[model samples]
Target: MTKADFVRRCRWLIACAVLFASANAWADEKSELKEKALKLNSITGKDPIDGKIKELAKDAENTKKMLKVAAEVAKEKPQPFQYNGAFILARAARELKENEIALEFFNISTQLAMKVKSASKLLESFDGKISLLYEQKKFDEAEKACQELLDLEIDPKFEEAKIIVLEQMIQFKAKQGKIEEALKLTDNLMKLDEGGWYFVRLKGWVLHEAGKYKESAETYLDTIKKLSENKRLKEEEKERWIERTRYILSSVYVDMGQIDQAAEQLQMLLKKKPDHPTYNNDLGYIWADRNMNLDESEKLIRKALEEDRKQRKKEGVEKDKDNAAYLDSLGWVLFKKKQYAEAKKYLLDAVKDEDGQHIEILDHLADVHMALGEKKEAIAVWKKALDTEPASKRDLKRLEEVQKKLKAAEGK
Candidate 1:
């Protein structure tokens, strides 16, 4: 109520107003920058972040515009926009092959995300960083980054991140031919996420990749059992899992030359899902390959090809021709039955189709040519098969066989 008291109070109110106005101005500026950044991010397609940059890079002026806006937003240093902007810049630099700049911004973004206690952003940034490092073939740095990610505080909600990091570690180790070390990490992941069927399957996949066929088969069987008991999956889901695992199991059995075991697995799968084209073709092919039950194998293969055509039609896809794999299976079974002319027709379609020309399919085509005494055609088909890149153990074996065949043909 006194004069001096009122003046002092008015001064304090003025100071408070100034501070509030300053805060509002700062917020307004931050919001504007965020809007600009969001707009830019949206226009950059959902392809790989670097893909956006590569496409954008095709137009230098637009790239310059986005780069400027992103840099300005990054300078804002607000809680989240700063980190988001840094990510954009990093992607752009990465695509531009400015490796040092990209790496620097990636580090900044991840560290900023951590400072804000955002677990999801941190994980995402870690993924981006590791992916960039991997793309650059800097395995050693990526390995170290994986270690750093593992060392972080993993809240239970984000505990899954630990497995992701381990997977990356296993991948690089596997790439470097450290199969034993990769196996150990996969084991660690299996133990950590044993409750999940996917992890158990991962272990079997690693073993299979390492050519441990017997162990892969055993592990897949174990996962099938574990998945069966999981109670989380209803009967239908469990049946689906069993059918798929058994399909994989059959492959390992075949690889180990346990032909009977493989046939049994495929038979079980067919019993459960009679219309599954893959299982039907696999069983038919296995039987024919082993020179057993040729008539039944041909029937199974026909049924598979028919089912596949029906499925494709239902899906609104054109099935004017047979599926390449199914055709190949039918061709093989007919070859086994010494019906070479009929087999040749199907095998020729397979070799000339878009989804066909698979090395094994080509090999089968070549074999059919040889059966028909078309030596020139056989040599040409075998040469084509040899030019195909072998992607698996089976394909590699076919390649080796083709190499021998080529040598024999040359000598003759």
Candidate 2:
């Protein structure tokens, strides 16, 4: 070869050798990582693997190292070990709010479970995947996951898992406004266990979401009747279910603009659990919003706040924070009574609470501001309300009303 060609060949060989050495080094490092993770899993003392993960994951650098080792172990380990390790990692990561990593491990666990034909593990993994997707509002992906689980030829021993998956599918369809599809899924759910009273209640919920108020009310009544006659349920359980269904039926009546029918349900519940914070607050808010029973509404709302404080204390909560929704109810009642200054105080405090950053609460506060002749403040509050995202169709309609209010105030 010529000298220039020989020199170029030598340089190319040197480059290839360096690349080979680097690749080997990386492979050795990866093997060591997998070895370390497998060793960690085998170390047994009061869940040493879990403890190590929790400790190591506290720091960002350590977390990355831990996740790398975990991923390698999950992907390369043998059956049972692979599934268990991946599941543990996914659970820990989810608790730590490392959602993307959690999702990856969950998918790995699911694949391993399917390969091993472990029906229980498959169900658990799918549950995790579906829950995370739902929380992230990835509804399309969640529905697909639910449908995949439903299509699985799972053992009859795991029929309960199938029922749960079917229930979730119904909810998913209902949320998407596919009322007929949701209703059909509910029928399939009911077929899994004919005596499942809860499934009947689920149908009531679907009907309510579909705006079939009369049918929803009828379904809830049937559920309540079934609960009353159910020999299987404990008395306490029966009462709780009946109370809840009655409360739901009240909401249906409210939506149908049958205020008297709604009041009857709340009164029945209050007679049984007079100090229930939610029952008191809901009935009070309904009355106050309609400018009916103002005095009774004020009393009920005050009682709600009192009971809520007591309940929080009993639960051993460190902070005795007032519920923002209850605060809004009280403030609205006061505003209805022309106590604008007092209403503003409670509404301001309501808006300060973490759960109080809602369009409805802001709308109430803006109205109070307007009543107090704080026109600029009202305008500012309304603009903030406009910026807030709506959570429901009702909220969207309320937003339109708020927009019109803003325009009128601005024009004035």
Candidate 3:
């Protein structure tokens, strides 16, 4: 699923919990404040809060009373109810975007859980803390929490939490650009998990990040075969993994300077999903980048753009015809074919849509301007790109190229 769909699917479980109307916990339970909250719920009768006004206690007065009672129970009860109350409060705090309070309450809930049972029963709750920290971009804190969690002797029931924490720690490390650290965690996970195509696919990703193109290519090829043979994964799941592995394989083979192998991989994908916009764009960009099959590349890029527009419209969203990356592909292809003015239009559209911060898009725009003899515009764009590029070897090389272009232009 797309990111938006994933969020929608899980939103109710996290933020908008349907308060238990069943004889579960809340129904069999009663405190003075809890009764007050329920009374308000009956009176309100579903004006808002999804027919469950008890989720918010209807108004501030009852909400305040509920908070006080929850706090008291958390201190005085020291058992199952305290754990339950803290979890509810944490969910409330999360909805309010009070990250610190949410984390504090979740940790409190876990601590209270240990008092109820000899072994920890709150790793799932502890997971809420990790997610909150990651959402707030507290990567270091999140990773530290992961390490602390792994250090604990979690119950066999909660052993699955270990895998979750490890994956989260790896994600945090990767987000902070510590790819090698993430690779080590991936290796650990591979050992812990039952052997599957998933780990093999992840190994390919790590190899690609480390710039081991030949190894990445080999692993990705293996990943496809393993994905096909894996009976545990559903057909849709296998399809996604296989397609992604094939795409990566093509890119890796291209980096290995085996263009024929790259072409064959892409051709294989297109045969399965002929109108796949992403594959069309990737193949188009590859041929454009290599300055081969210029006419065919143009056709493929245009088709990709057209398909994207149709798909977006069908999905009930704006068509976004000026998508910067696709425009860049088309513009670059046109420029390679010496169609300078036509290329200039598409490049400017790309820069406009990308808002001038995308390094490669700005570079393409600057080059187009230079080709059009618009020296002043070209120099300005090059300087902007130079300032915006990040501190990486590839980006530093981009900076140097921009600097060289600026210097050469000024000299004339």
32 Cα displacement, candidate 3 (Å): 29
Measured against the true structure, the TM-scores of the candidates, in listed sequence, are: 0.65, 0.76, 0.64
Better of 1 and 2 by TM-score: 2
Task: State the local distance difference test value for candidate 2.
Answer: 0.85
**How well is each residue in 2-52 modelled by candidate 2, as lDDT tens digits?**
999999999999999999999999888777756655554354444775676
Distance (Å) between predicted and true CA of 261, model 3? Answer: 3.1
In order, candidate lDDTs are 0.79, 0.85, 0.73
Give the TM-score ranking, best first: 2, 1, 3
Winning model by lDDT: 2
Q: Clashes in model 2: which pairs?
A: none
Q: Which one wins by lDDT: 2 or 3?
A: 2
Q: List clash counts for every candidate, in order.
A: 0, 0, 0
Q: Which ten residues in a row have the lowest lDDT in candidate 1?
A: 37-46
